[model samples]
Target: FKNAGFYRTVRKNNQPNNNFKIEVIQGGLFSDEEIKKHPGIRHETTQETGIKHLDGTISMARNEPGTASTEFFICIGNQPELDFGGKRNADGQGFAAFGKVIKGMDVVRKIQQLPDENQYLKEPVRIISMNIR
Candidate 1:
């Protein structure tokens, strides 16, 4: 759905100046009623390789309590602050990570360093296409 714009950036409820450019690994299923029920579906120990708990690592986005969908991102750098209960998840929970970039490190960096004056891209990132394997 992200590729088709079904979902929008996970903007902070109150902080109107902060948002992340996360990647949606599998997007279409997000609108599916049954799938939304499983929030912990794509997460594992944050120590896994490629999907390690590093910055620039792409992962799944979820609601505060754990409502994951097909959306994910490549952490531009090490962001333990976004880890479970870190600054980003001050509520004592955090976003679920599902995958990482096997390629495209440059793209991730570019997106991360973008002029996020409002904490979100003035021109938001858009997915061109998606595939499943």
Candidate 2:
């Protein structure tokens, strides 16, 4: 997990109190090619974990419309919109969340406040630490 990329994200969740931190490990954030072969693997993994919405912590990845690679985000809020809205899979289903942040939330807030261009952060936030559970 030490080598994985870290991202600070803001969620467009329905709740005003929605916002938090998340960390992606298993080297998932560093390769789009790797994810192409196992589409929706993250979503499946989340269901098995039985944890949805770190409450405030959020996670990010490329939008479901295409292949998601080295970019990931943290939940700044509860993003129900991401869960539904006719946003289906190949068969038409909603996207699924994979993981959450267990610590380092202050880092997320700092990253989100960084300057951005066209909404994408001008500079990618750095990962302070990552650990496998």
Candidate 3:
């Protein structure tokens, strides 16, 4: 995901229908054009990885407990409602949290502040490139 991902959508505490202070920005090949560019990929949800959704947490974005894929999000604040048994989802299945932001939090926060309509960013942030040590 280092080079194949882009900052996609975002959810803040102000969004309607939200009951908790949830703030997250989802990322991946969301657009159809982008999805076609990166084809034949797989990510199994399996189960909810137990980890409190604190600031800077990175996790997989899924509709159901078994449908996780390449899409991921970064937590902005201590979003406990995203945890298992939380109110974010009705099924009690939380997101698949695997890591946290080691750096570039300033950049992440800036993404959250971008203009969005119904949680979708107006100008999607492009991932120039990335490398893992």
lDDT of 2 by residue, 1-133 (tens): 3345443333232224424222221123554555554555343323444445444334335555334444455555454434434222332333345566777666666666665543445666555566646
Task: State the lDDT of candidate 3 residue by residue for 84-122, as single tens digits.
Answer: 767788877677677888889899988888887778787
Estimated TM-score for each candidate: 0.56, 0.54, 0.78
lDDT score of residue 131 within candidate 2: 60
The deviation in Å at residue 47 for candidate 3 is 9.5
Residue 56, candidate 2: alpha-carbon lDDT: 39
Clashing residue pairs in candidate 3 are none
Q: Candidate 1: minimum summed lDDT over ten consecutive residues — where?
A: 5-14
Which prediction has more favorable TM-score, 1 or 3?
A: 3
For model 2, the superposed segments whose C-alpha errors exceed 4 Å read: 1-50, 54-71, 84-92
Query: Which ten-residue region of model 3 has the weakest summed lDDT?
Result: 39-48
Instruction: Encode model 1's per-residue lDDT on 4-82: one tens digit a residue.
Output: 3222323233245445332322223444554555455644435433344475455666654445655455465566655
- Candidate numbers, best lDDT first, in rank order: 3, 1, 2
- Give the alpha-carbon lDDT of every model: 0.49, 0.44, 0.71
